[model samples]
Target: MALALPRFAVFQSTVRQKNYLRYIHEDGEQHGFPQFSGEEIVSPYSKFEIERAKSTTAEGNDNGFVHIRCCYNNKYWVANSISSDSFIIAGADEPNEDQSQWSCTLFEPIPVDGEVGSSTTTTTKTTVHVRFRHVKLGHYLRSLVTRDNYHACVSTSYDRRYSR
Candidate 1:
């Protein structure tokens, strides 16, 4: 069976926030973990490529197994460790590496008052959120509540406050 692949997209926070996931630019180049930038502007640093993992079977395709690659730096997102609260960084330069793959699940767009879907006919663009679980770390990528820090890998089995 052939699976339909989703187009590349830029991820944004859905908790009534304006933050978008973007790679950090430092020392004259885009190098480092991606962070939530609330600049209200979508740029190349914010774009990401999603591709199907090579190890998946026809059955596994339905599970949404994939790899996320940063468009700015050309690196795959990876979780370094299984320990809770590990920083999910864009470190892997190779695609389909064990640590580079993720299980992606797209969620329905959240409805807000005075926004799209509030009326009978929706015309404005809607925002969709996604949940990506690291294949090797076995943790879900979550946005940090603090505005100063980057997103982290949190164990779904534990409470949010105790993520670290």
Candidate 2:
């Protein structure tokens, strides 16, 4: 049996109630995830189109939603409308060491009377209510199944599992 991964919760209060984009850095800098300043250069193969498509699909909804674009090795991992506060990774890439980049965008909640017309207008109060959760189940797997020091051997696992 596989071990269960740990869960992380991102609350609206923790992230601040603001509708703005930012990044989380290794040095505990919430606004420094990319380790860069100014406009970011994205790859042509990046899932910019896919991200826009997904965002379009989430057009009007009352629930809070957030989209996060994670870039690494010229690859883009787009997570849309992550309503949950926690994330469980059976096995995932590392944080800072992997040279991965992440950008978070908060979307305003759609109004209750919003319509789906050409000029539909929704009174969605712009606020930051997206959260992130990083849980690693690899540790339990290593201790229970492989019986090897997976945490110490795999750099990615080590960073994701140990780093805060």
Candidate 3:
């Protein structure tokens, strides 16, 4: 016999706009806009965090550098760089049981093309394909909000290091 699960009611809140400038610009240095004062506005929900990472080959080496961005409440942390033969899978696919539903999967590292750089200033580019499967409803919802937060942090960190 299979056990039955209870259904929980879902509640929706009114959407409001709040000052996220502080989270966006946690660092003291300002670039695009002036510092924002703590202000509150009506919002349905708070924003979620998300992060992105990249890998590249070093000059004269067959292997490349793999970077995994760290998560932060505020967008201002450096991505921890690592040399590995790994990659992350990202995407969505239809669920097995429900055609109307979708799933997402995080996979292990896959092989990628890498090239060596000649000088320190040199850079190489490569394309990566990611796929998702077996995504859960709860995980998906959480990911939806978290992804944005992660992205903001990664963007800020990348800008600080690469941008002139």
- TM-scores across all candidates? 0.63, 0.21, 0.15
Q: What's the residue-level lDDT of 90 in candidate 3?
A: 17
TM-score, predicted candidate 1 vs. hidden true structure: 0.63
Off by over 4 Å in 3: 1-27, 30-56, 73-164
Number of backbone collisions per candidate: 0, 3, 21
Angstrom error of the Cα, residue 89, model 3: value is: 24
lDDT of 3 by residue, 40-125 (tens): 32221222222211323223432322211112222221212211211111111211222133221211122222322233444532
Between candidates 2 and 3, the one scoring higher on TM-score is 2
Q: Write the per-residue lDDT of candidate 2 for residues 84-137, one digit (tens) a residue.
A: 321211111322211122222322222223322232336633332222221111
Where model 2 places Cα greater than 4 Å from the true spot, the runs are: 1-15, 18-21, 26-50, 53-67, 70-164
**Collision count of model 3:** 21
**Model 1 misplaced stretches (Cα beyond 4 Å):** 1-5, 27-31, 57-61, 97-127, 147-164
Tens-place lDDT per residue, model 1, 1-164, is 23333558777766536777777766533246677764554798788887766655323234446777888888777654445555656777776544343422221121123232223445644443345555555555666554344332122332454222
Query: Whole-model lDDT for model 1 versus the true structure?
Result: 0.54
Model 2 TM-score relative to the real fold: 0.21
Q: Deviation in angstroms for 108 in model 3?
A: 20
Highest TM-score, which number?
1
